[model samples]
Target: MSGKPGPSAAAVLPELPVTFRPVRTRVVLLTVGAGLLVVLTVVALMMPSGGAQPWGPGDRATMIITGLLIFALLAVLSRPKVVADDDGITVVNLVASRRLEWAEVVKVNLRTGDPWVYLDLTDGTSLAAMGIQPGGGRDQAVRAARQLRALAEARGTGQPGTR
Candidate 1:
């Protein structure tokens, strides 16, 4: 045998660094939604007459709570995302987040008129990956779906203990 051995699979194949996020169109919604919230809050608070008057000792606390809740909700909805590496992917939706191994995903499906990409898992469950929504534009969504499929085909097949 030659002194040099054949390259191993890992050495021959480089990992794909993949990330998916809401399209730029989301910026518009985020800007408008957040701006509207801030404006309404200010208006309502200032309408108290002669100036912005403290409603009461509890006013500051109330405002803080309200603001935080609204901000958190908006942030979550407008920031759904997915990140995938060689091992697996992490999906972040509006109210939940999940980590999944490649072998867990059975298929990637994005049908016509569908709002977002959905991953059909081997465990008979499905996950909506809203980060690549059709609202972002057909072309963008298609491209993202293709990339995700390629990643899945490359690293998300059956494996020991994962099948």
Candidate 2:
């Protein structure tokens, strides 16, 4: 032996577990939707009103519904606990949550129409890794995906060909 130390056991061996940032698509969608709703509401309020025209039942109902929706959307967006962490990869669906181990993932695919990063599971199922989705354009999403892939590889949990 050259007496030089071999690869450190910690370096050569795969990390037993890894954690991934939870997805946040629902939160993002909800926030954008809420903002749009507020804009529309403001526009409606700004429209010229007929002289002496009282609000009708239908108009009142529409206003009430819109108000309720705005409140609900705001409430959903305010809570910051949407992200989840777990033994493997944490999944946050805004209304749903899932934890998946490395073995459960078969591959990672990024396609044009798909847009978001997707994980192909061993059971013929797939999950979206929304954390990697670009909020603005393709470049941001691609960058996020690359970072995620690098993290997975560092933990030895990435699917083959991911890097």
* Full-model lDDT for every candidate: 0.69, 0.52
Candidate 1 regions with alpha-carbon error over 4 angstroms: 1-15, 48-68, 158-163
Q: Which segments of model 2 are wrong by more than 4 Å? A: 1-52, 56-61, 70-86, 156-159
RMSD of 1: 9.3
Q: Tens digit of lDDT per residue, candidate 2, span 1-163?
A: 0111223311232233432332354456566767767776665665545557755556755765786687576655433221222345665543556777656655555566664677667678888765555544666555444444444444434455532
Best by lDDT: 1
Kindly list the per-residue Cα lDDT of model 1 for residues 66-135, writing each as its tens digit.
Answer: 7667766667678788788877988888788899999887666677888888887888888998888878
Number of backbone collisions per candidate, in order? 0, 0
Assess the local accuracy of residue 80 in candidate 1 as a C-alpha lDDT between 0 and 100: 83
